[model samples]
Target: MKNFLVHSLLLAVLLTNSCGSSKINKTSNPAVPAAQENVSNQAIVPAADQLKAYLPLLKGKKVGLMGNQTSVVGPNNEHLVDVLLREKVDLKFGFAPEHGFRGDIERGEKVSNDVDAKTGLPLFTLYGGNAKQDSIVKSIDVMIFDLQDVGARFYTYITSLHRVMELCAKHNKELIVLDRPNPCGDQVDGPVRKDDKFKSNVSFHKIAMVHGLTVGELAKMINGEKWLENGKECKLTVVPVQNYTHSSIYKLPVIPSPSLPNHLSVRLYAALCLFEGTDISVGRGTDWPFQVVGYTNPVYGDFTFTPGEKAGMVKHVEGKGAVNYGLDLRNINPDEFKFTLKYVLYFYDKMPDKSKFFARPEFFDKLAGTDELRKQILAGKTEKEIRESWQPELAAYKQMRKKYLLYPDFE
Candidate 1:
């Protein structure tokens, strides 16, 4: 009776939070209504919450998790690590990506191998390229990947996913991906990555900057396309999100990382992240990271903010201790946003010294997955012209993406 009552209550909230329709409405931010009302006929259940579907796969098998702070389950957003331990799933250890297991560690900081304090489980650092990943994979019978991805190429979690997939394939181990709804899954725009020469941790696969697929679908693509070394495929299984389509506007219950604190920041990430390669500051140390972009010049904007050292949130602050002037996009309508280079282009044109605009042109190319964008911008190409150049490759990528989709597409 107690269990029944709890399940019933959660179900009610789930239904309320969901939008049962699969229609695409690009004119409004669906997050607004979804957060306010739970009136849908069905609940959008993440794969992690559907324990019964995966618990059997773990029965008597030693398991390890490639997860972090966002790897949670249920309406209350309980950590999957805790739930797995409670269920006696024989969880061996954990693999933390860029941010440490708890998401406390700041970006670009080296994540060292350590023991999780609360769980007392060993954690292998996968962010900066661990030397022991081969042996780590050998120790586990099955690997469960449940990190929340914001549907952007440069997020690094997906890169960790690719690394894990490769190791699992190399070791001939089964891999399970507990899928979650990508908040930015509805929009699929931007440049497709070129060949291996431009590949880095951020742009691991030859996918678009805003690749519109769940991690499960991406896992499938990695295997189907034989992108793995020696064309080997991991024994893959994806426990997909229930009642979710590409167009589903699912608000994340937990912040995916330290930098992206809210839906607005996430909505603006793919657009602003490109600025990282430039001198522009994407509000790193401010209260609203990724919600604004500025540089240490008055000509950039009238609104001013000085970044400072923020422990656990930001270290190695960009434009730290200096007044930065640029656009404040905190209140911009989410519906009006699309993945575009107009912001970067605008900043470049406004830059007093165009050479200094691309402070790290090479890094920018890595983020863009090609150097053509930087070259195009230097040549003073319009946004329309740049977007048009991507059409041939983008169209081809769209067709290729169709084979791996697990749900209804936004288009």
Candidate 2:
């Protein structure tokens, strides 16, 4: 206990001294939209920024933090883990989700149990498919979840959210989700996961491709709907984002993952991510990942880029050692971007060999949350026809979504 206190004090001092009075800009790049410098007059304050509201809850409890690189507080972007330590919150252990504690781990990479070197805290991996963190969940009095979500269903942090919530419910531990603005909170398009066979880590719940709910709002839905094992409900508390509405054009203070480097990449992710199931590369392993899509063939497009390995970010480079040709969308206005199926459809239509287009059909379906989409594209269904087919289910989901919403609706 004495050593831990000493270490905590040192960390606090180091962090405090490092961040004097210099405020970090929302977006480092001048080209991308700035953070919370959106259309709304008020800046969206994340739940983590309001420490007073939640610190009391952890005053004496053995708290466990489930967070990643994006789990930060304020303009200085001090990590919540460090902030909690500074506040003398009895944080027992740290939990890492899909991207690991620092968010360096590659997408879909298996995170293993380890210890956080910085804080000397035991780190358990919740990204492990099975609920192996049962013991960790039981040891904690409360689990604080704070990860930035990109508002896409297949992003996998939400999957980690489900597993953590399930374990919390089973062990009878309180789960607190620190809400952050969904970069694309207003978007609620794409096919809702309806098929049981399509269930995977990516498609954890039956929601639209872009659910448009903040983590806090989604937590309410998860508990309210009784989606847990045997309809179990977690003792959930959601610290919602202040001055945020569904329509608020909030930009992320930090990149959610390594691939989504800028505001534009994050905005385009929902649309381009579908290309993961295809032979085409979504600029993975490149500096501008998710901001461009290309293939080795010159017929794909005039714009060209080469995919290369990025250590800890992407281990296996997709479309490596060859020039890939396709769209360059780094300069597109993020605010104007809307979730659409047209990009993937265009690539599919261009592919000379239809079978090669869906290089990983099963994986594609898992990402889509339904096999119907692949079948629809294969059948050459127009975007209009495809969107029309989703209306009935989408309409029902929208109605159900309203019950759990914590902010004003976009509509």
Model 2: lDDT to the true structure:
0.75
Error of 2 at 17 (Å): 38
lDDT of 1: 0.77
Cα deviation in Å at residue 282, candidate 2? 0.6
lDDT tens readout by residue for model 1, 86-121: 999998878888767767678778777777666677
State in Å the error of residue 75, model 1.
Answer: 1.5
Instruction: Give me the runs in candidate 2 sitting further than 4 Å from their true place.
Output: 1-40, 129-132
Taking all chains together, the TM-score of candidate 1 against the true structure is: 0.89
Error of 2 at 224 (Å): 1.3
Best model per lDDT: 1
Pairs that collide in candidate 2 are: none
Whole-model lDDT values for every prediction: 0.77, 0.75
Kindly report which residue pairs in candidate 1 clash with one another. 16-38, 17-38
What is the clash count of model 1?
2
Output the worst ten-in-a-row residue range by lDDT, candidate 1.
Answer: 11-20
Q: Where does candidate 1 stray beyond 4 Å?
A: 1-41
